[model samples]
Target: MRTWRLVRVVTLLLLAVSYCEFFHYYMVLLLCTWPSVSSVQGFQSHPLRAMFIGDTHILGSNAHWFDKLRREWMMTRSFQASMLIHSPDVVFVLGDLMDYGTESSSTEFEYHVQRFKRMFSTPFTTRTEIIVGNHDIGFHHMINDKRYERFKEAFSAPSVRLISVKDVIFVMVNSMALHGDGCSFCKEAEDALKNIKWQLKCSKGKLDQEKVAEICEKLDIMNYSRPILLQHFPLYRTSDSNCSTPDAAPLEEIDIPFRIKTDCLSKESTDLLFELLNPRLVVSAHTHHGCYRLHDNGIPEYTVASYNWRNKHNPTFFLAELTDQDFIINRCSLPDEHTVFTLYAIFAILLVIVIIIPPKKQKPNLGKSFTPSNKDH
Candidate 1:
């Protein structure tokens, strides 16, 4: 009886844990899908609204089952986001366009892009740009100039590009640059970063200005209201400080350890970039979980969740409305119908198998061991 009771208790505990997982994400979806009552009535589309996606990791032929699952789930979730109210005018694909991006994989890459395009449901209407990711360049967690060039040929996108939405600037940086030393692409990225400073010089007043006569006069050169930095890896896992430990797990996904582990970005370079360009917002995706916090400078930095991750119950994307007053960012979950169904089905099956089955009865003795006998004593 005691053993049966323990078994039941264990099953109940397991069920509770699973329920919390589903409930947490479902609630997130519900909350994000609906706008507040005031916004529903008064809200109109902003002039330059944008949608941001996390790492896609689009898989190709002869890939593992998980990769295939990731691809399909991401497509469904992305489609759902696009269909929602206040849909984006421009969609920014941060990076990781392919599982292991290469010119040789161009066919697979193009196919994924087309599928993604269809999913977004804005093939021709909405403008979209993809930046280079570490995988896109096949740099072994670093940047390879040759592969970077080939990635451009494969996709016809620059390694680093600047996008403008009204007065807001989205600077896409090639995160592969800081993956290793002696990277030629790093130099190219530097020049690109330099150009960004010049372009956003007039927007500096928005960060902190008394709006004095001199500052107001300089506003003529205002080509941007604020700058948003987009990249693959987070600058530091948090808004402040650096995170680089060789002993830390290799940042690669599901691969047997073979290469020397290194931090996602070099502390030196990240510090320099931060010093040179203190962006109004920083968004990135590499870790499969999502995070939103403010940098030491009070700038918002978001580490987005991967759509391909099943464990990350709340697969998320971002929506931004660049209003005159400020930029409002909302994180929305990508609802995966199939996964949700599978989870519930498994839970139900476990309950029936464990709780519905009865334990076998054992012989009972009254204060003494009972021997098999021909007749009862």
Candidate 2:
């Protein structure tokens, strides 16, 4: 009886420990709700539900096994939990998908990609799209053909891509290629941007029919929508010091200056992108913290926080409901690393206590034990 009681208690404790580490994400299934724009809430359109994840930064060979396992598990659980609840039509990974992608060999890079797929796997009905990040390839000045090609092959990511979902056009750009140096990659990116611009113009009925026939023969867009710019780097910004949004960089780091073209796109590149794309909304992920800012042109940009625990204590993602003329972005947070660790610590202490403290020894039933059965004598 004592053994069984002890076993039951231990099992319950183990279950609690599991919940602290893994099952915690399951709560978000109930907690997370699809936020709606009040004005458009009553609209009868089937809004395109899209989930955006920031830098996953799947660690490479150099990371410790425990760190890799912990971080990856957190990402997997959070993503899968939210996916189950939201059932988004499309998912966008806003770059920096790997930590050492630029440094890894072909085999190592492949492994990272495989691991990322496992971590962020989604249902077949939901489409996944990715954009290239500086880490996925390299900085413009240091990018090489081998690295760039391997990344593109791995993720099917291009320097610039246009995807239309539910009449909402998402312009995915490789921010790394926006160095404005007119290198071969830069030139290619610019050309793709021009093509995308023409497609948008055609959609808006702004281009002459002849112009559309000349350049937009392949674009089969049936409805018009402003482009939503998706990239790996944020637009030009000095720093997040003045950013008042929740989950902005920590107070101490907010004032640190961002390096032009490295931390953010160069001013020239930013101007060129805005002029060409004329995006109604922009979403980027390289900063690894949340920032909601409106450009001088009055377009809103949401910088998603990193989805990986290694980047921030409180990781988060963006849930966007997009329509042809409206977009609503909600910042959804994941389980905090510090909170999870604290729970683990607490559970470990309780588990130790359960093991160390002896189960009470039941007082022997003296009457029954000592009273001998009167056999027939």
**CA lDDT, every model vs. true structure:** 0.61, 0.86
Candidate 1 lands at a TM-score of 0.64
Each candidate's TM vs. the true structure?
0.64, 0.91
Root-mean-square deviation of Cα positions for candidate 1 versus the true structure, in angstroms: 11.6
Model 1, 1-377: lDDT tens per residue? 66886678587767755563434354445555422211322453544677777667666666788757655654654455354544557877777766656643556666766765555455455677777666667654444556666667655677566667665677787776654355566677777777666556645544445443544554335555566888887775322222232112234532332222222455666665676576778887766556665656787777666666533544667777664335667777665546666776776677676666767788776686677888858
List candidate 2 stretches off by more than 4 Å: 1-9, 38-42, 208-221, 366-377
Candidate 1 lDDT score at position 150: 64
| Candidate 2 collision pairs | none
Model 2 lDDT, residue 307, Cα: 90
Q: What C-alpha lDDT, on a 0 to 100 scale, does residue 22 get in candidate 2? A: 62
Best by lDDT: 2
State residue 140's C-alpha deviation in candidate 1, in Å. Answer: 6.3
